[model samples]
Target: MDVRPAAEADHASILAIVAPILAAGETYAIDRDLDETAVHEYWFGPTHEVFVAVSDGAILGTYYLMANQRGGGAHVANCGYMTSSSALGKGVARAMCLDSLDRARQRGYRAMQFNHVVSTNTRAVKLWQSLGFEIVGTLPKAFNHPVHGYVDSYVMFRAL
Candidate 1:
């Protein structure tokens, strides 16, 4: 798979990859009913940098990286990732994440943080851990999972 910076032209395919994940409301904290305009602004807004992973000209996954906070806390990077359901378990997400981390370090970020990783998304949680991110804290009843009801969230971080 090839991972590269995203262009406006990739928006449609990115949406196609992200839509099902958002609709599931199981992993990310975003509104399941989130609209395209909002997603566009959030993903491609001025402060964020987005990337896409492709295989044979098909967008299999995408990720967005941005400052974790403003001012003093801005040295850290924050990211969100999504892989097309059809592309799951194929290492597309992992490749995208590795590329994002490299980009984050190149952008001068000192650390990378994931503010709200759903605890029940075991695959993702484990993957993050394997990638060297530590689960620093747990926010009890933080995510209202669609099927699992209230679930915990993990604050994961890793030094660049």
Candidate 2:
């Protein structure tokens, strides 16, 4: 798979990958009913650098990396990732994450953090842990999962 910086024309493919995840309200904290414009802005906004994982000319996954905070906390990076449903279990996410980690380091980030990982999303929690992230904190009942109702969320971190 080829993972590279996203171009303006990649917006549609990014939206296609995100919309279902948003509608499910199972992982991300975004509002399910967000319009295309808002969703586009949220994913491709200036604050984050977005990338797409492509294979056979298809966008299989995407991720965004940015400073976890401004000024004093700028050394830490934050990221959000999504894989096309059809591409799950095919290592798409794993590849994107590895790429992001390298990209973060190259960009001078000293650490990476995931501020709100829904605890119920076991696959992601496990993936992050395997990649060296530690569950530093947990927010009880922080996320209102559509199917599971209120669920705990985790704050995961790792030094680059």
Best by lDDT: 2
Backbone clash pairs for candidate 1 read none
* Candidate 2: tens digits of C-alpha lDDT, residues 6-99: 9989989999998888888899998999888988888888898999999999999999999999999999999999999999999999999999
How much does candidate 1 score in TM-score? 0.96
**Model 1: per-residue lDDT, tens digit, 41-120?**
66677887889999999999999999999999999999999988888899987898899899999999999999999999
TM-score against native, each model: 0.96, 0.98
User: Which stretches in model 2 have alpha-carbon errors above 4 Å?
Assistant: none
Kindly give the stretch of ten consecutive residues in candidate 2 with the minimal lDDT sum. 37-46
RMSD over all Cα atoms, model 1: 1.1
Rate residue 28 of model 2 by lDDT. 93
How displaced is residue 4 in candidate 1, in Å? Answer: 0.3
